[model samples]
Target: MVSDRNMLANILRTELQIHKSSFILGSHSLICIFIYSSFIHQHGGRFHLSPLREL
Candidate 1:
């Protein structure tokens, strides 16, 4: 029974870590997109296709 409890605790801890990391990554990407869009907006809403073409 004690081993089962330990396993459950470990699983919960790993799950929390995964969620935290994912949230951080998601927020980072969101911020990047927001900044990029704002930059384009400042430039009269013209999206430069050169960068996409490079990709």
Candidate 2:
């Protein structure tokens, strides 16, 4: 039962992280256009994760 709960929590956390990443991308694009007149042609506005996540 504890393992099952942990799995569920892990899934939820991953989903939330994906959602947050998308949000940050969207916000970055919006702010870049607002301040710079357009989105920068770079890749700093991305969120990357490690190969293994234990959290």
Best by TM-score: 1
What does candidate 1's lDDT look like per residue over 1-55, in tens digits? 9999999999999999999999999999999798778768767887776644433
TM-score to native of every candidate shown: 0.80, 0.57
* Candidate 2, residue 7: lDDT: 100
> Residues 1-55, candidate 2, lDDT per residue (tens digit)?
9999999999999999999999999999987556443222233544334312411
Model 2 off-target regions past 4 Å? 36-55
Model 2, residue 35: distance off in Å is 2.6
- Candidates' lDDT values, in order? 0.84, 0.66
What does the lDDT read for residue 39 in candidate 2? Answer: 25
Candidate 1's C-alpha runs over 4 A off are: 47-55
Clashing pairs in 2: none
